[model samples]
Structure formats: structure tokens, C-alpha cells
Target: MERLHHHKVLTTVTWLLSIIISIYYTFEKPHDGVWPRRKIWHQNDKFHTAFRLNSIIASIYWIVLFVLQGGYIAHLFSGTVEHVNAACSVGSHFIVNNLFHFAFVMLFVRSYFGWAELFIILNFFNLSSLYFRHPGYARFIHTPVVSGPLAWTFIAIYWNGAIMVPHPDTLVARIFGNIFIWSILVYGLFFIVVYKDYTMGFNLSVLSAAIGVSQFLRQVVAFQWIFAFVIMAVLFVATLVVAVPAATGRDIKFARARAGDTERAPLLGEN
Candidate 1:
């Protein structure tokens, strides 16, 4: 019990500190000559590919994600058996994620794309391990807190790669960028189809919109934004279809008199 208390406290403090550092970097200069993150992103407009996300939309998405993270933190202290077990299972991940995020921000703003990519990759594996270790596959809170960041970072790998190489608005680079943009759709669909997770789909859709908006704003006569909008539409429709069950015109939970069998059986068996 004492150990659990310490773990929760550690995670909470790490979360708070990470958020503070992130906000500080967002608005203030990291040092004497370093520009704020937004400025760096804008100043490097030439380096941006078709995959670059809109800063404003991305900021809104981050705000929503962090809010969901706070909910996850509160769940840890709920003291219920399920909550406690969940905290014990994956609580350490929160701390690792915070640390990696802090490092990534620092490295990214300082123009250390290689090291920043390394941290993002490490964070990806950290979150992946947490997902596998915890039994809650697509549980409500777990989806956003765990899967959300995972999906974002998966896209970040590509986005960071593009910037690192300074994809100079060349035909070859633009062609590859257009082709690679759909990878986000593939990644989001895999989880939505396999795990019945809409949060991943929703998050990725928002990202796609951000990308589309950014591309359109930057290059109005390009195919990249069109592809992004198409991807967004497909993901949004898919998420809606998968999330809400069709009207079966019946309540199936108690359809069987002996629904609670000694050996568990799949719901709605073939008649």
C-alpha cells in the first residue's frame, strides 16, 4: 500500500512538471538565442512537408489529450479495486512518458532532430509495453491515455523524419509525402478494426484535418491536402460505424436464460 501511494505521487508530480515545462517552452524562449517552439516551426516553413500539421489545431488536440491524461491520473486515486489494480499495472508508464516528452520538447526546439526522434521512438515502445502489460485493451480511459499518444507519435516519426531531412519542395519529395500521408489512415484503421477503438480513429482524423488544413494553407494548388481531406473523411465515417452498434431491435445481454454459463461463450451465437 505504501509503495502504491509513492508510485501515484511520483506520477502526479511528473505529470505536473512535464506540463509546466511544455507550456513554458510553448510561449517563452528556451534560452538566449533559441526561439519559442511555434516560432521555430514557422521559421522552418521551408522544411515542412505536406504532412505538417496546423499549429493551432495541433495545439488544441494536445490540450484535449492532456485533459484526458488528467482524468487518467484521477482514476489512479479512486481507491476502487479495478482502479488500483490498473494503477499498479501501468502507473509507471506515466512517469516515463512525461520524461520522454520533456526531453523531446527540449531536443526538438534546440534543433536536435536525431536525439528527439530517439526519445519519441523510446516513448513509443514505452507506451506499447504498457498497452500489452495491462489487460484493459480498449477500456474507456485507457484508449485515450495510452492509445492516443501512441498513434500521435507513430505519425510524429514520419513528420519528424521529413523535417530532419528538410524536404525541400521537390517533386520526388512531394510525391513521397503524398504517398506516405495515407499511412496515418492505415495505422488508425488497424487499431479501430482490431481493438474496436474509436478514440484512435477520432484522434487520427483530427490530425488528418490538421494536416489537410496546413497543406491547403501552405500550397493551395497541391494534391496533398486533397489526399488528407479524403483520409479524414474515411476515418471519420469508419469510426462512426465501428463505435455505435447497429440497432438489433433487441437487448441481447439477457437473451439467454443461462447466459452466465460455467464456461464463458461469445455473445450472440449463431442461431
Candidate 2:
């Protein structure tokens, strides 16, 4: 009981600290006279590629992601036995994630792109570890808390790398960008097809659409935006076709197993 209580306390404290630090850096002016963290993309627009997401889309997505996290927080304190145990089981993972996330934001806002990329990459691995560790976590709780960030950070690896390199927008760069953009499609589908991770597929699809819109607004005649939009469509369709059926099958099997167990159990008189 003491251990569980400690886990809950630690998780809540870490989450609060992360939120405070992230909000302050992202929105408020710092003593260093640097632009607020949220403005980094606009301030560094010269380094942006066709993969950049629209600010509006990015804003809405984070808002929704935070809301989902809020739901998980509620679950952590729900007072139900199952909820408490679930929260404790995953508390450590969330603590590590929050620390890495805020640290990444700090480095990123300070223009330490190389170090920022390293932190984000580390967070990516952390999230992947969580995903494989708890593959059966309820989607409603797990999707936003884990899978959402995982998908974003997976693509962010490429996005951050691009900014860190700060290359010229040359013909070759655009050509390679167009080719590599499809890798996001492949990444999203692998999870959806192999693991039936619809949450990842959905999050990646939304992100891809956001990138497409941003790119289209940037260059109306570019191949990157068109390919991005296509990727979004494919990911969304793949989730519907692959994950939906697999989930339905799993639920059906679970119901049948429960029925079988009930039938095989001995009655009180027999015992």
C-alpha cells in the first residue's frame, strides 16, 4: 500500500511539474529575451521544410492530447481498486516521459537543436518501451497518454533532424524530402498492420494531414503536400480496414472465453 501510494504521489508531482514548465516556456516571455517557445517555428521559418505542420493544427492536436492526459489523471485518482492499480503500474513510465519532454522543450527553445533532437529521440525510445510493455492498456487511456506522443515523436525525429541540419532548400533537398516523406506512411502502417495499433495510425494520419496543409499553403504546386495528403488517406483507411476487424475479433474471442469458463465451473453442490 505504501509503495502504491508513493507511486501515485510521484506520478502526480512529476506530471504537474512538467505541465508548469512546459506552459511557462511555451507561452511566457523568459528573462533571456528569447521568443516564447511556441514561436520557435515561426522564428526559424527559414529552416522549415515542406514537412512542417500548420500552427493551428499543431495547437489543436496538443490541446486534445493534454485533455486525454487529463482523463488519465482522473483515472489515477478515481478511487477504484482497478484504476489505482493501473495507475500505479504505469506511473513510472509517465514520470520518465514528463521529465524527458520538458527537458526537450527547454533545449529546443534555447536553439540547441542538436541536443533537443537527442532528448526527443530518447523520449521516442521511452514511449516505445512503454508501448511494448503494456500492449493491452485500454485504448481510451493509452491512446492519448502513450500512443499519441509516440506517433508525434516518431515523425518528430525526422522533423527535428531537418531543423538541426539547417540545409538549403535546394532541388536535391526537395527531391529527397519528397522521397523520405513516404516513410511516415510506412511507419504508421507497420503498427496498424502488425500490432493493430489504431491509435498510432489515427494520430499519424492527423499529423500527416496537418503537414500537408502546411506544405500546401507554403507551396501550392509542390509534390510534398500532395504526397502528405495521400499518406494521410492511406493511414486512415488502413486503420479502418486492419485495426477495426482485429479488435472486433479479439472482443468476440474474449466473450466466448468468458462463456466457456462459466460453463466449466463446478456448481456449489458439486464442490
- Quote each prediction's TM-score: 0.84, 0.84
lDDT of 1 by residue, 41-105 (tens): 55335466767878788888888878878877887788565555554456677788888988887
C-alpha-based local distance difference test score of model 2: 0.72
**Model 1 lDDT-worst window of ten:** 262-271
lDDT of 2 by residue, 62-111 (tens): 77887787787777678675555555556677888888887876776676
Top of the candidates by lDDT? 2
Model 1: pairs clashing at backbone N, Cα or C within 3 Å: none
Per-residue lDDT for 91 in model 1? 66
Cα RMSD (angstroms) for every candidate in the order listed: 5.1, 6.5
RMSD of 1: 5.1
Worst 10 residues of 2 by lDDT: 262-271
